[model samples]
Target: MTTATTDLAASRFALARQVADAVLFEGYVLYPYRASAAKNRMRWQFGVLVPPAWGPDHGEPSCQRTELVMEPRGGAEVAVELRFLHACRRTVEEARADGTFADVAALHLPDRVLVPWDEGTEERVEMSIPVAELEAGEVCLPFTRPAREETEPVPGTDGRTVGRLVRRTERVDGVVRLRADPLDLPYRALKLTAVVENTGDWTPPPEGAGREAALARSLVAAHLLLGLSAGSFLSMTDPPEWARAVVGSCTNRHTWPVLAGEDGRADVVLSSPIILEDHPRIAPESAGAMYDATEIDEILALRTAALTEEEKREARGTDARAAAVVDLADTMPPEIMERLHGAVRALREITEPGAQPVQGRDGPGLPGEEALFRPDTPWWDPEHTDPAAPHGDRVLVGGTPVGPGSRVVLRPGLRRTDAQDLFLQGRTALVEAVLRDVDGGVHLAVTVDGDPGADIRRAQGRFLYFQPDELAPLEEA
Candidate 1:
């Protein structure tokens, strides 16, 4: 078995954390990008590993285990950093007059409840224990009845029966413990498990709104994503013999299917060691701060028109840094430069209100200009005009210009280390569409000629996306 030095493994761990952070806050970039947005409030939707028996009545405790294979370089010691959601089972209860508990009940009262007359009079009552309060463990809260005579209860709770004027405590006393085994390099796999449990004595919330009920009994496991550190020498192409064996048997290089058997247990297995080449180790405290900068850039792009002069100045400063990085790194790939240039241009447009829109070489705009022009729309939408060609006229395949409906062949050497490289070298494909990514990079969407997988091709509309360098135009015989 191959081994990685402690430093190399640490760097890889940092990169994994970055990828996990990206997955964690992906939806934050959508419209109404505020924490208060209703859509934004629904968190931890990605990479959720719910138990098969996870439901209101069953509420059976489940554990999510992620196994990663790593080897230290030169017999050096390595430590892995893992991050994920820590899910805890929380109960939302409403105190009833009979000392019974109802999940999220409401209270109703007259517009003007004469203290003496309405004391015992039954009225519809509704109340909610804030999620934050519940996470903090036992606490009392006052339920103030709105001065309205409404016959209806709260939207998702049971309010038909009048409940007692008792306050309900919302507390997060549950703790999810994570345990990891050291990288016994002699063995090929390292395992980590997140065990979910409830701490305090509390009954599960009664099934009400589907969403509310899920939150009530669900155990939220935090930082469930796995991060591994391996030596710099190991790469996707030149992996150790053991790592290669593990990846060779798997369908995906980066993400694998973690199925929960009837026993309600699942395992996410990763064997492809992430190669960190000359990458710096980021301090754990600064990990989130780094992501915060990227988030700010996204927010600035969305509200470019509304930025004030001071904000515009700051945006320009960021543009300057990006430009300087691009300039200093002349050998940097075109994709990197294009991304930096896009940032600069985006900021320039905001700083210079009357500036003309940047045009592509061919004409006023490149093909599929709508995607580039309207950054607010869903960039990944298939219906959007292709950013690479407006009229679907021509696309560059392997640096050679080819028109739509043309034949192309996948070129080798461009396989992504993070995802499955579906297109094999020398495989034939049909040029179906040309699209531009958010970074202003051009991508060719092609359909494989002999692929018979209906689930991937028809059901998922799975098209092999390739950079111009990854595809070559088919030549006539």
Candidate 2:
């Protein structure tokens, strides 16, 4: 390849790694960052592949599979990388006068605090194969991580070993299998399947085992980063009309495949355990990783900064990554901190006075310009003109027009991820307004009827939001 082509590929690979790194450590550590935190104890909940013996009995998966549509050029090949964390148990011990050492959860040295914790060692298995090879037959690549243990001695003021830190890792083995099938669609394309299984030999944890036991013999944060040496891969989430049916036919087990790297480029796909939009990018303003991807960076930064000196010391002793997060929070510059508070991606100035009003999804919006967006009012203003006028909008629920003040029965759908939504089922609610997300999806803001606290909730302009389809219109109300 030419130098420019190689440089572009290198750049794209780096970009893909940026997003994949976020997924890799999404829940690696929580806000407090201290090992003593309760939430920190129940960790490794995402993208975990346990031993086959420890199946869904404990709600853990033993395999991850991703299927994608690839318009392969003749003789095109693909490179696959399975990235995950290898959990290593670290134990802190203190030496006694009798030459015996006892395990201590925390041991304080003169310069730093030391804590025993399960630290993750980043592990990856990568392989490349020709399209002909995968099309002809399944190609299996088996990998293994051997068991090992290491010790680091802590010196006392007199330079003698006062304590020791022991790290132990178990043997981990897995396999990645790849296969391709040619499609007979209008265009030349091939369906590719990649499967990752924890083939490690191990006895399953007893029934009702906590996540920690199974995680010891599992592949934590297991995800695949796929690259096409030639040809583009079709997005599983948003495919063209012609490939919609094909995309639907593709099956993904315990993984969500989305285009990665450069925007609108399909050369790389990140098959993440957590669902992600295509071309996911880390915020340029992000100072460092806190591991809780759902929370805003500014909030996390503030919370980290609020940690007491002792708490921060414990967090620093928890893991190397946690130390980095604590350091970043304590020293973040004011300018960078402000940038994390808010970011504007787009701005439009009203240039014409005679422009028509913006047309909303439900009906016409307040008119003053060609676009409904007003320069004077914030985009979220309830009384202002906007593309999606929530208060003025009505959604059809079971052929019944439901809008503000309309009564409906809540029936939370599969789209609701929270378990609390179960209580909302069959509950009658008054639709406060119709809210639209940036993706153009409509949501119904509602207040539960007959609830004593609902009135106060309404007064505060706070209402529970649900998808329009998760509601049923009441006939009489």
Candidate 3:
């Protein structure tokens, strides 16, 4: 008979809310329950709820149940690992072909497609996926296998009576709302729920006490990740008018910067392709509307009043670890930040060929613009290395460079192959010098012993770094 509403003022619930908000992002709250399942399995049932914001945009959360057997560790902690695969029913083509209709067939790929959305379109999509899939960054479907057996059944008096049946269940459901024209530029809000159960001795956390405790822990984790107050978790506390206005204005903008308004905080419309790619299990609709920052602040204050000094220390330590991985962009090294920015740029460069790369101070990059590549840095050179080396160059583009004496003049309209040749050879061609062309085809400042175009182009782009000795492979290209 107990519900989450029973102990809103309890410090445990407050802390749980903060932690959930932080780790799960705004507009989502984790709900945990103590329940018994089919057999002798110990589990905790928990989920992220999107509230009314997800109602029309997505839909009511669909309930599901899955059983997973775990190796018995202890009463306090248990390890139950689940892997999910192509779980989502819808695909990128389906979502983009018509934001309003489920036209595209389902697709299961390592990475989610970048769904484009247009302005003035309201997108609501709800789908059920495993919680493990959400954490793994792909649409993970359940495998057609039953729970694994850990320990054999207890022997009966007759050596083997009917084996005792025990079932452990784990299920996760997610919902998402992608607003605006998803075919053009889509912004999605997501929510997820994970339920675990032991058919045997399943002891639910104390209603008010348990829910409060779990929620507080989740929020603290989120806070550690965002570096923002738990109050900043909610994006809807501000007037709906503001959100609508911001969404409308940002619909056409290419890089929709996370913005702050009269709400006294910053928020980005949930249109990030990264989230969909990283959190495949989360439905686009599950991402909730902005919540009241004040609500989060108030919750923190209440939690502060309730926690013991010892509990606070323990909570802080747990939060630090969770934040390290969950807080995207906020917690990354300079090198990683650069690679992330570069990948984004590469995607943009490929999709929007005409879009000019930002330059000097005007470029859009990580906070300090430190991640942006400078035009003078020679497009042929690896962004991380010096530009002068041609023979010992480790740049892995797939084209070759002409010798220094050989004239290699490049202008607009050259074949992509020719351009790639210069790049692969680690030489500069007098390629188009337009703003967008900074990273495009270029001349190779050819040296006497540069490799051929085929060789150079073959060594252009790779995931791993190559050593100077590896440059000889370009000769075969």
CA RMSD for every model?
Answer: 18.2, 8.3, 26.2
Pick the winner on lDDT between candidates 2 and 3. Answer: 2
Candidate 2 wrong stretches, greater than 4 Å: 1-11, 98-100, 156-159, 205-210, 346-477
In the range 239-302, model 3's lDDT, one tens digit per residue, is: 2432344333332111111212222332111221112211112112222212222243223333
- The digit string of per-residue lDDT tens for model 2 on 296-411 reads 99999999999888888888888889999999999999999998998644232322255434434324322221221233344566755574556474666666778898989998
Q: List TM-scores for all candidates, in order.
A: 0.36, 0.75, 0.18
List runs of model 1 lying over 4 Å from the truth: 1-37, 41-43, 47-53, 56-63, 73-210, 213-221, 224-245, 248-341, 344-477
Candidate 2 root-mean-square deviation in Å: 8.3
TM-score-better candidate, 1 vs 3:
1
Pick the lDDT winner.
2
| Worst ten in a row by lDDT for model 2 | 365-374
Query: Which is better, 1 or 2, measured by lDDT?
Result: 2
Better of 2 and 3 by TM-score: 2
Each candidate's number of clashing pairs is 43, 2, 86
